[model samples]
Target: MAEIALCFAAMALRGFGGVLGHSYDILVVRRQWLSEREFAEVYGIGQLVPGGNIINVAAILGDRWAGLAGATAALAGLTLPSTLIAVALLGLASKLAGEPHVASAERAVVAAAAGIVLASGLRTLRTIREAGRPRLVAARAAIAAFACAIACVPFVGLPIAVIVATPLAFLLERRAAR
Candidate 1:
């Protein structure tokens, strides 16, 4: 229990913005707890759930390994430290809200986070290709999904855009698979 908590806590700390992507590294490369395919399987399950993929990942991974106790431990470890840090940062941001540089810094941080997310995705695609899915249809679907999301973000908003694009993307996948 302690070890599971510690590992997930470390994963959260190390992952920051790209938790799922980083999980591939920490779990597969470092811990050897899961192989590349298993990591993909776990992450696919995480995506199937509604809320945050990373949170679902921690819970599912915990449950898979050690049942309820593991789930609790992993969730607590992932949330507690991150929550405390987020609260402290939010408080600080509120105090600094009027400063021009603070706003700029926030944009920069958000931009960096987006870059990390992009890189994580690229890494995942590369992994899938390396794992023998190199036919390029998945890549095309990803590009289409991304383009649709970009267009839809201004039209319908992000959440609805994602909701809409997801099924379209899946359909594209089904087509690609055939």
Candidate 2:
């Protein structure tokens, strides 16, 4: 449990704009906690479920390793450090809210965050698509939908993109199947 906490804590600390990519490095490459395909599957499920993907992953992983106790530890470790930092940053941002430089910085941060999200989505999609399950035709539709969602987020934002992409993905998949 301690190890799980520490590992997740460390991952959280190192993760900034692109936590999922960092997770792939740590969990799949460095820690060897999961194989490539296993990480892909876990990440896919994490994304599909509600709330933050990484938090979901930590819970799933922690539970896998040590049941409920481990899940608690992982959640604590994953959230605590980031929460503290976000609070501190919030305080500073509030103090500087009216400054011209602050607004520019905030804009820059938003742009960067959007880029990170798009890149992370594409990376995860590629990983899932490469898993070599040709029989799962439905997976192709999902991949197309996810790709469209990623593409649209930078333009239309998430909710709208998902709303528009879902039906389009199914249509494309159906056409391809014919």
Candidate 3:
């Protein structure tokens, strides 16, 4: 239980704008708690759920390990550290909001976060290919490209884009599986 809490707590600290990449590194690569396919499946379910994806994953993983208690520990570990830091950073950001350096730092962080997400995607793609689903790469990439394009459209928004893209992705997957 303590280990689960510590694992998520560590992930929380490294989390910037997103933590999916960090989650993969810690849970899959470093800790070896989950395999690539397991992480991908967990992450997919996490995205489908209503709340934050990583948070959902933490809860699920915790529950899988130690039932309700594990879930509680994981959630606390994943949220508490980051929440406290965010509060402190919020106060600081308010104070430094007008500073040029802060603006530059924000841009840099955004870029880094984007890079992390892209890398995570690539890693997942590789995992899919290696999992004996080699034909999925082109289909998955096309779906990703379509989702990205849809997300960039004015007022289209991520939710709508996801809604639009999901069935298409499912269809493509089904076809590819055949």
Candidate 4:
């Protein structure tokens, strides 16, 4: 039980820029607690469920670690700190709304966030390109993924986009093979 709490706390503290990013991957890939395939499966299951994916993943991992009690403990630990921080920030923002320095700080934070997002996207592209595949095939796959994401915006359903693209992606791979 202590071990479970420690594991959950470690993950919760280390996670930043959202859990779906490298944080979850670290738990699976670096720690060897779960295989990559297992991580992907758990992520998929989280997406299928209604609530936040990170919370769902935490719950799943917690349950795996120490059953129901572990899940409850993990969920509380994972959410409480962040929730408190959010509430504090909101209070501060409300108090500082008319201050020029506060507004400037907020804008700076937004710019930094944008920079981080751009860097993350480029890193992901580089990873895909370097994944031992032909450049042309990888490029095509990237384009297809981009198109699918765009289509998903109008459709408003990720599963529908996946359904539509899965066979198309397979066919593209087959064509590239030949």
Best by TM-score: 2
Candidate 3 per-residue lDDT, tens place, 76-138, comes to: 999998899889989989899899999999999899888988897677656545433545776
lDDT of 2 at 43: 88
Off by over 4 Å in 3: 1-3, 14-53, 118-141
Clashes of 3: 0
What lDDT does model 3 reach?
0.86
The sequence of per-residue lDDT tens digits that candidate 4 reaches over residues 1-178 is: 6555566566666666665675455577667888888888988888667688878987898898889998988788777766787799899789989999989999999999989967865665565454345766565667667655766586565666666666776776677667
Q: Which clashing pairs does model 2 show?
A: none
**Top lDDT hit:** 3
Query: Which one wins by lDDT: 2 or 4?
Result: 2
Span of ten consecutive residues with least summed lDDT in model 3: 125-134
As a TM-score, model 3 comes out at 0.64
Model 1 scores a C-alpha lDDT of 0.78
Q: 18-131, model 1: which lDDT tens digit per residue?
A: 577677777899999989898888889888787888899899999999999999999998888878888998998899999999999989999988898788666755553432
Task: Locate the minimum summed-lDDT window of 10 residues in model 2.
Answer: 128-137
What's each prediction's TM-score? 0.64, 0.66, 0.64, 0.59
- What are the lDDT figures for the candidates, one per model? 0.78, 0.82, 0.86, 0.73
Q: Give per-model CA RMSD.
A: 4.6, 5.5, 4.5, 5.5
